[model samples]
Target: MMRFVFSLMIAVALSPNAAIAQDKPSKAKSWNLTGQVKARFDAKVVDMLCEVSGGAACADKCGGGTQQLGVVRKSDGRLFPVSKNGQPIFSGAMADLLPYCNKDVEVDGLLAGEGDIKIYQVQLIREQGTKKWNKTSGFTKAWRKQFPDAGKKGPWFRNDPRIAKQLAADGWLGLGKEADVAYAKDEVE
Candidate 1:
């Protein structure tokens, strides 16, 4: 009885299920904000992650001119990642704030999940000392025009065409996994 109890305890302690819970990557099925709270404030457009870890210059290096934009609140300097559905509001945020980079923007939207704002609608976007609210659509159009080569290359061009070309030159069709093939021998199709 003593031997069995000790073995059981050891098994329980060593079980993978005994590990403490860890944060999983956000993979929300529904891309919609919950517990929505209406908020309106002015903040400067900044590159979300880089702005926090590195300074403005490091922020600039991300995504060429298309880094995911966030709002750094003027009052508290709290960085709110502008996102909807748990994902960074990629193109839409970029379209709205590309021209307004490092400039103040008046945001009105639903605040949700960690410091993300769900911008279902735009209230206004104005630079300091400017009464005129700039057009949001033109930011995307201008980006395409300016960086014609980099445009339409998907979110930040991490999957740039040049990389594929290089892979093709090396006689790779860009398929298959880097994992051990032997592990899949028992995986019945």
Candidate 2:
């Protein structure tokens, strides 16, 4: 009986859950891009300025997508500024993370950048303790809401009337028709 009890204790002590209970942060699992890695971790969304300054009014200062947002790893308190999302050009993760500002969430995405400049590209997120994962589609949703007349068949930039108007006014090279003609002539030569 004594030996059995000791063996059980040892087994429990060496278990993976024991390490989790101690609050050790999990490392990224696999490499996705040249400098990006797949990571899933619990973090608290925060306003970058407020979080770095140790300000207690982070929730109020987040500014509803106006101010920059980031996540602080719950296990290690490391702050990762979320700069992008799983979207094409001119898109950002701010809209996705803004609603959860100053709250805990589970994030699954790619971690990119190096040295002192780390960026978290949120691909999926859910409030802490929630079972349903929300896709990081806030940028597209917002764009559609703002530009209801924009067709949905192609890339957002190509479909955007504002960009189309600008391109038409400035020509393809944005340096007037003369420059565009000169560039085309040079290309043909």
What's model 2's overall lDDT? 0.76
Candidate achieving the largest TM-score: 2
Q: What lDDT does each candidate get?
A: 0.53, 0.76
> What C-alpha lDDT, on a 0 to 100 scale, does residue 51 get in candidate 1?
87
lDDT of 2 by residue, 59-115 (tens): 564987777898888876788888777665668898788889889998877777643
Model 1, range 1-189, lDDT digits (tens) per residue? Answer: 999999999998775320211112211233355634455566777877678767744655345555776777676666767642212424454556666777776655445543332333333456767767543344445445655677465654344456556755543433443332333554544
Which pairs clash inside model 1? none
As a TM-score, model 1 comes out at 0.45
The number of clashing residue pairs in each candidate reads 0, 0
- TM-score for each candidate, following the candidate numbering: 0.45, 0.69
Give me the displacement of residue 110 in model 1, in angstroms. Answer: 2.5
